[model samples]
Target: MGLAVVSLKKGEGRLLKSGGMWIFDNEIATIMGSFVNGDIVLIHDFDGYPLGKGFINTNSRITVRLLSRNEQTVIDEVFFEKRVRDAWEYRKKVVDTRSCRVIFGEADFFPGLVIDKFSDVLVVQSLALGIDRYKEMIIELLKKVLKEDGIQIRGVYERSDAKVRRQEGMELVKGFIGPEFPTLVEIEENQVKYQVDVKDGQKTGFFLDQKYNRLAIQKLCKNAKVLDCFTHTGSFALNAGIAGASSVLGVDASALAVDQAAANARLNGLEDRVQFLCRNVFELLPELEEKEEKFDVVILDPPAFTKSRSSIKNAVKGYREINLRALKLVREGGFLATCSCSHFMDYELFTQTIGQAARSAHKRLRQVEYRTQAPDHPILWAADESYYLKFYIFQVCSDR
Candidate 1:
């Protein structure tokens, strides 16, 4: 049987033309030829002109994910090897390669796959059925590419438990990809040590995307009393401790996270100065206000409050409330570091929300710095999804 061809409705290929990789299910006018789901298919515009090559998944709302715009480019081991090599090279050029996001899904052109390298370990999160079929081959090629410089990957772990996989008819599951090994892996970044449990940790263990952003707060931490809200595994708090903070208090709702954070503090020999509490940040903020508690530095690194467009309204409210509380808790002329990891919380909107929070808290904010996800997790132009993570640092002061 010949290959399948997907013809998009008129003007439907605009996202692809504009450099995005997904083709929504509703955009296709029709699919011809015999092909099953997850098969490579040719895409054409309404005028019958070839668009590119992509993997078709009838079960997914993303009907097809274009792999290449070049009509003749072949999708094989060689293609995957090149993509991995290029991604690794980019990381080597811009960020610390020891622990970084090697392949960031569509950002690196592997439409539905993400690979994060932590020391000698690799964690994979496969999100699409069409791409799932090629995951093994991709991992092999990734290892091969990494080995060119005598670097060896000890193990590969699959964390393909994202709910999006269910939309593509895949079950939520995670396990070692090859030989079994201990899941708790120790890795160091910016001189901070972390014991990452890939099997149970959030999104491939440690949040590598905030690697540099954590370093950005170091200078402001010397001898300061700092508060870290939503402190998963005590990352920001530990960074502050390592930065010579006088005392650091990290808070999280998860007792497990608090335990891990405390363990991490002990691991780094900062247990004396670094403390963690298992408490909801929202409630703790009000209590701190009641006691007139204040910190010389406050960090709010909350999880994504919004994942979809529809939740943005409520997300905005949540963000504003927490930020307003956080701002009020920061001592006058002290630092406030805040961030939102939700892509749906666009840059403009997140910044605007912060401004509203500052006004509501009756405080003035002097912008100190702005940052985003580390370069290893690069943001590709025209691929809006690649551009998440908006970080801001401000000097808070009483209003005029």
Candidate 2:
């Protein structure tokens, strides 16, 4: 088959030359022919020189997601196997836990694909139409790689609930590929045990990316009061309680999540020290403050507020509001660990939002650490968007 061609405008060569893979709608001079969404396209400069190969999507603002910069290379099954094997090798060497992100989209040279390893199971989410088109090849490589490593390959689950999939003109898909569904899976990270529900739990059944950030808070939890906002399954609260915090409170809006959090605390034998509350975090923060409830350590790991450029400003406001309230509720010399998973909100913007919140709350804040996703979730330097996870741990002091 003749290659579908995408011709770039005059200066767009700069973005590609500088290692950017995304070709926005505005960058295209003209698309040579009609291609189905996720079809491979050969990108060319205005001079008609072959630049790279990418996945085409007529529906999205991002028209092309470049797969390889080498113009001569074909994106075949063997090519995908090589990428998957490289991603797997890096994760096995870097990540200490079995439950970790195996491939983090652009970070692993396979943009729009994320894979999480949970013990014997692998959960995959293909966010881009391009990667979705090659799902079979990717899965085949994953199975082969796991088998070669002597790892028990039990099942593969697909969780493509992300809104990006819709933007890519793909339908949501969730189910198991193997014989049996994993009802419950236990994973240990930072000396804490977590039960994951691969069939229904959020984002591949667990927030494995936050493994390091949760452990950072553990060091400061000795005999201190702790509060975990947006506590999906009580990972933070349980860690605090296990670290000898005097008391730990976990709050989340979902009843199922709250129930699961309570059960998780009990599973870790920390029920006596941890409490779970099912309430909206935006409302609960102020209510807790009005009741004169203060905490020595507070964690706010909310869902992504902005999925695209249009919502970034509003998301910043939401981030500021929650951090402002949380900052006010922290006792003097207390610690605050907050995070945002929105790729649209860059690290500078996110930290600036937190700084603005501290200024408004009349609190003195000193950042103790700036963290990102764990090693397994490697961020490719060439693709900045893959570095979406941002975590900041700060020491709070009253201006008074």
Candidate 3:
């Protein structure tokens, strides 16, 4: 079939005009050519001016995901090769090239694909249905690019098991894209070691986006008692222990994650200084408060409370509750490193929530520094979802 044409309503192309790549269903006025859903479509304004080319799907609310603004561009294997090369080049310049996010979906201009390189292994997630069709091509091209750099990806694991795929009318998939390898892979970052379970771990096995943020606590935790809440795999706690913290308590509700954290602690020879606890952080925080327990440093790196904008109200409350409890549990002049991973809870809203928490806890916060996800997880200005992580380190002062 020839390329389908999608025309936007008058004045409805404002977002696409302002640099955003999404063309919502409500924004479209008409489709000029007949084509199957998930087909490549040419997007145009009502006046018939070509805007760009995107993959269109009637199943998802995000109807069209613009692949390129250049009207003359071709969507083929060569295009994907260049995209992968560009992503790699950017990573080499701005991030730790060893084991970082290679393509951050829309942030890397790939729209619906994410790739992470862990040593000689790569994990891929193709979220949107439109991109799933090109998944094989992308994987093959990426392998070629890596081989040119003298890196051989022994295996490619697909973690496209996200529930969001249902909205795209696609089946959830998880397995080795190529040859099978041990699902567990070990890698190091910020002088800390981790055993990433690619087949079963959260969000592509390991959360590489927090690579440097975990290292940011080295100075604040030296010889001090540290508490890491929602410590998935105990990354922050391990960093604190390795940084010479007197003692570290890493808490997580998941027994499996706690076990993994313990294993990582042993792997790093930090078991003596770091301990893992299986408990709900919200429940444990109040219990610790009741015991008048205080820590020199507290790190809150909770999973996203809400994924949709509709739940932002409840998500904000959750953030505030945790922040308030952490602030109250910190020793005077101590540090509190808290963050929200929800894109719905944007920067302004997150900071405002923390302020409210401080007031309620009768504590004052001295802003130490504000950091987002590591550079490997680049935030595209036009694509707001790419800028989800909001990390802030603040000194807690007693109002008393």
Report, for every candidate in turn, its global Cα lDDT versus the true structure: 0.93, 0.87, 0.92
lDDT of 3 at 273: 91
- On residues 1-400, what C-alpha lDDT tens digit does candidate 3 reach at each position? 6798999999897878988879999998999889888789999999999999999998988999999998789999889889999999999999887899999998899988999999889999998878888989998888898899898889999999999889888899999887789989999888899998899888898898888888888989999999999998888999999899999999999999999999999999999999999999999999999999999999999999999999999999899999998988999999999999998999999999999999999998899999999988998887888899999999999777
Residue 183 in model 3: shift from native, Å?
0.6
The residue pairs found clashing in candidate 3 are none
Clashing residue pairs in all predictions, respectively, total 0, 1, 0
**For every model shown, what is its TM-score relative to the native structure?**
0.99, 0.95, 0.99
Clashing pairs in 1: none
- RMSD of every prediction: 0.8, 1.7, 0.9
Candidate 1: misplaced stretches above 4 Å?
none
**TM-score of model 3 relative to the true fold?**
0.99
lDDT of 3: 0.92
Model 2, span 1-400: residue lDDT tens: 6878999998886666777668888999988876888888899999998888999998888889889987789889889989888888887788774788878887777878888888888888988988887886788788898888888778888898877687778888887766776568887778778888888898788988888888888999999999999999999999898899999999999999998888888788999999999999999999988998889999999999998899898999999999999998899999999999998989999989999999999999988999998888777665677689999999999888
Candidate 1 residues 223-319, lDDT tens each?
9999999999999999999999999999999998899999999999999999999999999999999999999999999999988999999999999
Single out the weakest 10-residue window by summed lDDT for candidate 3: 13-22
Which parts of model 2 have CA positions greater than 4 angstroms off? 33-35
